[model samples]
Target chain A: MSLSALVLHKNDNVATAVRPLESGDSIDVEVADCAVKIVLLQSIPFGHKFALQDIGWGERIIKYGETIGQATASIKKGEHVHIHNVEGLRGRGDRP
Target chain B: MNFMGYRRRNGSVGTRNHVLVFPTVICASSVADMISRAVPGTVSVTHPHGCGHLGEEKEHIIKTMVGFCSHPNVAGVLLVGLGCELITPELIAGEIAKTGQRFEILSIQAEGGTNATVEKGKTLAAGLLEEAAAAGREPVDISELIIGTNCGGSDTLSGLTANPAVGVAADILVTEGGTVLLTETPEMIGAEDALGRRAADEGIEKRIREITSATEVLAKRVGVDMRGSEPSPGNIEGGLTTLEEKSLGAVLKGGTSTVRQVVGYAEKPTEKGLIIMDGPAHDAVSNTGMIAAGAQVIVFTTGRGTPLGAPIAPVIKVSSNSGIYRRMKENIDINAGDILEGKDSIKTIGERIFREIIEVASGKATRAEVLGHNEFAIHSLGLSV
Candidate 1:
């Protein structure tokens, strides 16, 4: 199956969209050597990331096998992950 | 592996034999430029520095200037100064003299005026070029090479494609007993802990944390948000959402080699392997620091294409995506974007880059070098007083 998204690491809960994905579009993803099908909940632009599983609010968001930020709102599988829903955990003077 | 390179008098190998006409102050930049143009095989190094600098800032400018003069790539140097600048031509010449490299100094005030200074500089530069041209390339081992790695105009595909591919190339170089210098201290903020794990010792790991924290503090003190500047508008448009995301991908350019040491800006590494230099996130400044630190060649990964190059080193531009590669074919050298299109694997692209490095070291002209994009800048620690 052609991979529409890339899972950078085995532990990452999000995968980057290699191609632009639209609402109601079903795509095949290679997650941990397994082929999984996901239906897009919203339009995910190329290079943007999408949730591989349901992420609760305030939960850590992992990419590149590291914590990039945390979820600001509950995100469902196939939802686009970006600034609107995710908050960066570093470089903010307010954060440790 | 062996490549043909110029063996310098101090027993260092140089990929280019360039006679450098270095201006000590911004005021003398024009004189240096005119002199370099008058003399064949000479290059001029100019920047907006060398005056109104306080303690550490003054010291850093002087050190970086001297580093450039004594860089292995430079065969000889002609220092041009305004005579009244805080960083005198004598001081810069004194430092370069220690490296046993041939050098000459000219002061605009002492030489009467611009035309006279340029005339004197041209004569001096011509002599240096004659000497520089005498040096010849000989077969040198790959271990003698010091390669610098950097990512600029980066995007999502950067971490996914070009960066990791560069990592593989870095690993191969390390395996072959060569050195790779990874810079941009500010970009390593959130990924410090992960990078620290690769340090060769606890002391080195502690230094990594200290430098990253200090960089953050510096940004906060300036009343600027690092986040806004780091994920620049271009970065955001290219799909990077956070500084952490950019950092996580940026660190992959260092490969898995143990962090041997952390050096100051423009400071050369005492040991080999993957050494990190403390420098700003700006591409030109970071690239200049590494070149001054003795990197004979630089591999720059870019998702958004840029035509940045160094005056002394051959900068091999690697495009992260095929789109940018196709759009800017003249500027880009390697296309790691094939990995994203599933046309090529990371290992294959990595090996190709590794081979390209050897070829460039052996005198292959990179696109930037051929296009004359000699972008150079020095990082300053504090405001010039």
Candidate 2:
């Protein structure tokens, strides 16, 4: 059985959970026709994103094959990607 | 294809024939409310502007008010003013007169007080409603339609299903020679390359950049990031992390039509096809700008389910999931969730929404209208002085 998740594009490094996914749940997702199986490292709420591979801090996070934001902290594979761990590079009024 | 609509005297097509009661200032809102309540069938709109505004703010308030007052969807307007406000009913009434539509003005100070003015307004509003009631729908070509596309309470599936579905409908409309307006400048943050590439010309491409980049500048000037706000707390809960991600999904409602024109807030478009109106991402005000810009109907997509309706036009909500669709049945009109459930294709859902638009334009009331969701608001560009 496969957990529900969707990867929008081949270049996207994150997959969004179509349903609530728990830690350790294995979801087989096609990252743009390239099938990859990822084990959840953290519980991902419905509509949330998870890393397909380990993402280094400050590395651009790709979704829809474009930069959505950059990782503020290092993200392990299957770790939840959210506001707490990522910062949008655009429209940043806080940065000098 | 043709749909039944009210053809105005100025050669404009109206999806609904409404007798509108408009307040020029917040102070006159109560008077407008009283007048509409007294006149049963009349619709009323009020805003937080009309007095003490300066420069572009004042002009924007007047233009928005005038746009609504002179909208083709409105059969007639009863403009109520507080007499001392900068945005006088006479100014708005004069603008409407140029459109050759029916309108009447009521000044509280000139009529002696709220009681006397409201009594006069009731008479005027009742007359307009009577005239509107007698007006019947005639066949208007589908090409005359200008649709507004927006998304609120969005989520990850929004991009996957409802937004793209709305986009499909937008594409269908554009193909049929109808006009489509896409706005929410704040949401267009990171999707510039995708949107700008679709521009009809070099000037249009520059405008797409100007509007999106301006949103960031405006936010920085206010000393706050667009993160928490543009994604919104609801958006974050629904899994949208950044303004770019949300915008990438948000813009899908515009479909893939060429960008024919880029308009200022509430300004009517001169070109057909997919046009962009510069405005913020807030749903109510964003909807307001499009309605003022001459969209007769709005196809709004939502994953979290927003119950917003325009005072003058119908808002057709497309839900992203069956769960939220079931919970907000009264607020939502169509279910694009079938695509996500593997029951319906995106193209199928889009055709269904396009069909719904024609039906709604033919005088079928939307859920928002049937449920009395007459939500209205004005965009604020600067601090009120």
Candidate 3:
């Protein structure tokens, strides 16, 4: 699927919506090899990120090559990512 | 490059010869407001904090009240008090006296009551208006100008464009011996080390560390992380992720000028160059702190755009993205988006902004001023009663 929504990076594992998209709508997203069909698992609003790869709890989520937050639960490929799946890492000292 | 302005005895040039009426205590705010309203070109600044504070907070309130009256923008002052408030009208009167300007005081108890106080205040205000109007404009050097820098609703383009452009303008102003006040202490959280490296002296570096660390520790005590609360929903949408990332862009509004001094909230900058004010990241209170600090003009960068303005000082709006600039042309005065579009360099835009600053200083109305968005608020240091 050729996805025109978000491209996290050339080597990253998530995409953000440039605009809002509904769940189950397939968008053509450019990834590795050819255009990949990304089916929205949940409605993604504009500017919100989505998982490009599987993420685990307590692991850092990198956006713009910086740590934005940590994954709270396991997130699969193309899953809608937001506050529910990511938790604020307070008093965690510093990011590595 | 010069517009007519009111020249003060202190060698400061004022854009407006406003008669300021300040209520030291909340109880006297109504009287001050009534007095200000009764006289044209008079302003009333009222806040709810002068009564229930102690030590440093009490001192902060008094200093702020003093600073506002001596702001250089005001031609004269009228201090109203409830007589029994912690900040006495006498003390407030003393502060105004130090400025060597015309001022009068009225206490509710001394004047018999609120009605009497208001009448007394109205008479005083009317007299002040005529006196201030007599103060004529004289030619003053650019060095006499104290400008404040702020960025709000930041986006990816903020750091890359608007902020750097502002930095250039600030650099020009600073090099020319003008003063620039850079504030929003919380926004400096993640960039302390970088800021420290730019500090002019060890004492300034230490002050920067102390203020940033103090805010961080306070946030931790409140069970909230400063980093998490930053990059608000709007900021995230604009491509900012971490607090550190947002701060890097935010601090660019300060330019590469040496950290001349660090001031507490509402404290005026005594020295010229780039001074940091310890204030909340909120625009309303922070802008008020800068205005109170004697900023005659303010250069505000907005990635998402804001219409906030000060009652006395003129606020110039700069936008990072050309898209937003095109969409909100009325709210934005200058567009730094040319940097993003590769149409111009930072220096080019900086010159344009510098010209606008002079133009506004010469009496050009900013978008906010044109829209009458003179919302003002002073940052509170202690608990409200």
Candidate 4:
């Protein structure tokens, strides 16, 4: 299967969409020496990230092998991970 | 590796030999511009500051002006002044004289009027240009190269593609004993710890924290949140969700190198390797500061795209995605988007970028230079009044 997205690091929990993905599309991705297949749960815009595995609410969204943010809500495999369900941990006056 | 560069008297190598018409005060900017226009091959450095600044703010402008004039790329300088501003042409000339470069000062008041000053400035600039033209590029080592890295109009691809790819190229440059500058302090908020870990020593790590925190404190004191402005509208639209995410990607351009030192805005680094400049994230302002600090070339990565270039330095623009590269083909120098398409590997593209840097350093005109995009801005720390 052709690679549809890029997994930047082995520890990254999310992958960026190289091309837009629509609901019901089955995608194959090559991550560090391994291949994974997942069915899109919703349409994911190009350049946006999607969950490679189920992420519970408030869990960190890992990319570049680092935590970029935390999921505001539970994110399932292939679900779009963006501002809608993620919260930045930096510079927020509310966060300690 | 060696590239043809103008060897300065002070032992510094310049990628381009240009006679700069530098204005010491905002009041004399028009005459400076006029002189630069009348003399071909001469460039003018004009800004709104140079008067009415207080304390550190005033000193920063002075230092940046001096640095720009003394830059190796400037073969000579024609200093223009209003004669009454805090930063006098004489003072600027004194600073540049330290570098043993040719410089001549013309104050509007001293010359009796704008018309007279313009005439004198034109003749001086032409003479300076003739002297500058006499200089020729000699073989210089890669270690003399100081490369500035910056990103603007960024998107998700910025971190994944262009930024990291530039990072790889930066690593190669550092390995070759060259210097690389990573700026945009506010952009390092979320990734401060990660960057701190890469510092060469505790002092640099502390300075890095100090500068990044200062930016945050200033914004907070002004009753604004840094996050509110970061991960800007363009970033959000391009799939970046938070400031941390944006920052994590933003720092990739520096590569995995030790932070040798953290310098104040427009401050030159004393040590080689990777240095971080303390300045705002504004594209043009940061680029200007780096150029003033003595970066002969800049590698600007963008996802949304910008056409910013420095007057004294060549800014090589790299587009993160193929779409923006195709749309802004005339402006962007290289496309790292192929990495995203699985057509090119990051290391290969990184080598290509490094080679492009060598080419630009050897007098290859970048898109911005060819388009005459002389975007210059100085970061102000205090109110003009």
- Each candidate's iRMS in angstroms? 3.9, 3.9, 7.7, 3.8
Interface RMSD of candidate number 1: 3.9
- lDDT tens string, model 3, A22-72? 888777665543567777777777556677778887777654334546788
Q: After superposition, how far is residue B304 of candidate 4 from its true place, in Å?
A: 2.3
User: Residue by residue across B1-385, what tens digits does model 3's lDDT show?
Assistant: 2446667777666766778888888898888888888887787766776687777778877777777777778888888888888997789778767777678888988999878888888888888888887877666778788888988876656775788789889988889888888898888876776678878899999999899989978888989666656656666555444565567568878888889899988887788888999888888787778877888889999888887777778899999877889899989999987764447667799989988887788778899988867666766666545
**If you score just chain A, what TM-score does every candidate get?**
0.89, 0.89, 0.71, 0.90
Model 3: how far is B276 from its true place, Å? 1.6
Which consecutive 10 residues in model 3 chain B have the weakest lDDT in total?
Answer: B236-245
Query: What local lDDT score does residue B354 receive in model 4, on the 0 to 100 scale?
Result: 93
Question: Where in model 1 is the C-alpha error above 4 Å?
Answer: A1-3, A30-41, A53-60, A70-77, A83-88, A91-96, B227-241
Error of 3 at B218 (Å): 0.9
Question: What is each candidate's fraction of native interface contacts (fnat)?
Answer: 0.34, 0.41, 0.04, 0.43
- As a whole number from 0 to 100, the lDDT of residue B109 in candidate 2 is 89
User: How high is the CA lDDT of each candidate model?
Assistant: 0.87, 0.87, 0.76, 0.88
Model 1 is docked with a DockQ of: 0.37
Give residue B303's lDDT in candidate 2 (0 to 100).
83
Return the top candidate by lDDT. 4
- TM-score of candidate 4 versus the correct structure, residues matched by position: 0.94
Query: Model 3 residue B13 lDDT?
Result: 69
- The candidate, 2 or 4, that scores higher on TM-score is 4
- Please compute DockQ, using alpha carbons, for every candidate against the native two-chain complex: 0.37, 0.32, 0.08, 0.44
Model 3 stretches astray by more than 4 angstroms: A1-96, B1-5, B112-114, B227-237, B322-329, B338-343, B383-385
> DockQ winner among the candidates?
4
